[model samples]
Target: MATNQQLTTIKCLILDHFITFNELSSIISYTPDLRRLHFSHRHERDTTIGSMSSIGLTNLTYLSLRIFSLNFHDFEIFIGKIQSKLITLSVNISPNDITYLDAYRWERLILQHLSQLERFSFQYPDSVDNEHRYFEGLNQFCSPFWIKRQWIFDVKIVDEGIVYVIHPYKKRCMSSIALTNLTYLSLRIFSLNFHDFEIFIGKIHSKLITLSVNISSNDITYLDAYRWERLILQHLPQLERFSFQYLDHVDNEHRYFEGLNQFCSPFWIKRRWIFDVKIVDEGIVYVVHPYK
Candidate 1:
């Protein structure tokens, strides 16, 4: 039972239930000035309601949805009703709810509906056994679009086997877009191959100041420290700080740090950079700072 004064004063709202279309409409109608809205549905429930009327939230700036079970059509219809010039939008959906086709449709709907969007993020739940395949699928079908907008791109792997690929914009790029406004990038990946790494770094045209990466080693052995130093110096000439974390390997002898002394000795002598290395429980942490 929200009073008119309370509704008018509400700037943020969170709904976590099987809310119907009409119910959601009524709620939005009440909160005329709402700036942010978050909805989460972790369980299946009856979402039946009367009417398909659209409602606009002209003042809303942020929207998020964490959905476990919702049809794509329903989700699309729900968003179609709200007219908001959102600056940020995040969607986390169960993999079961969306296919690659649905992902394409989502991209189109987002670009069409939220014309003023500046930042966007998306995530699909993954299991340990299928994580690699899931990422591989994304690599094949998903094209990088956020680079054109100079938006932050983040991929986080949680301990619970959840993989999140969050970027600040939507759309699939037909070709490479130079990252002119990006200044910092942080990546946490299971394994990054050398060619992929080179291609990824070559896209940044801005004067990047900081970079951090946590990588799990794969069979590829080209990601040595010397190679990394060369790539950074060549691509990111204005880099001021670099942080690298390596996940431990089962065979300690073949671990990346085995050649650390060789890599650091030459890097220390040749480059005007100051760096430190630490052996932590998770793995090794290497921090490098510009000598200036």
Candidate 2:
């Protein structure tokens, strides 16, 4: 005889295989204090998970779904059953099944259902050959509200063809929830326009204490380090540590190296700041520390 005692005290549930709607409901009903739920399905099987009329997860604070084969309609239906004030929500879907317009719908659905959400992350499997096109699509998919909320955002290029964006949840000013507890930022991107970079950095400038960025050598050809120095000085006055890494040969005779020296030498000599350079893996790392 299988005793039902274990399900009553379950607070966290992680389901990786296919489950029917009735099974899901039974699990929920058994676990009244469930606080976290994660469902991940990586295979491309056409599995039918039946739907429930109404299901409430009053105690659920974290939810994550990584179903690459689920279509938009099915996903919407499955998510509609969840009624929880989730603090963190992460979803990963297939690129083939979602578009830029669909992202807007996802945003609206999240705002409607997870009203008290404090952290959100979304990603899709990138289509291998369309890096530039995928980048443009991902940017278009981002919500304006998220941009204004100072999300610690990122779009990484990886071998598995994955696009990721993560940010803190948006909340009303009266709410006791604090802003993102982030103080350091690190970015590795194929390319970023100067204006876009400036706008992105401005969002977290108030609390940022350290920054590290790795830009492609080709992207930095047109960038003016002196102009960037001015921008950093003006916007990130409280920033105490900074580092930049890139894959460009920087011998003593290189004009780029000279340019970097020209931009940072004044800050070090006049402000008693510390600037150091290191060569690593056929690249360079430039680090700057504020004067103590």
Residue lDDT tens for model 1, 1-292: 3466656768999997656555667677778889999877544453642245666688899998876666677777667778778889888787655352244575677778877787777777666666345444444234554455545434467886766565654443335658888889887766567666667687656678888777665633443667777787789887766666555544455545556565556665565555556677755555544556
Candidate 2, residue 203: lDDT? 58
Candidate 2 local lDDT, 90-149, one digit each (tens): 877666564522556767776777677767777765666754454455554456866654
On a 0 to 100 scale, what is the lDDT of residue 150 in model 1? 48
The lDDT, on a scale of 0 to 1, for candidate 1 is 0.66
Clashing pairs in 1: 120-168
lDDT (C-alpha, whole model) for all candidates: 0.66, 0.64
List runs of model 2 lying over 4 Å from the truth.
1-7, 41-50, 129-133, 162-164, 167-292
Please name the candidate that would achieve the greatest lDDT relative to the true structure.
Answer: 1
Per-candidate clash tally: 1, 0
Model 1 CA deviation exceeding 4 Å by range: 1-7, 16-18, 42-50, 100-103, 128-136, 140-144, 150-164, 169-292
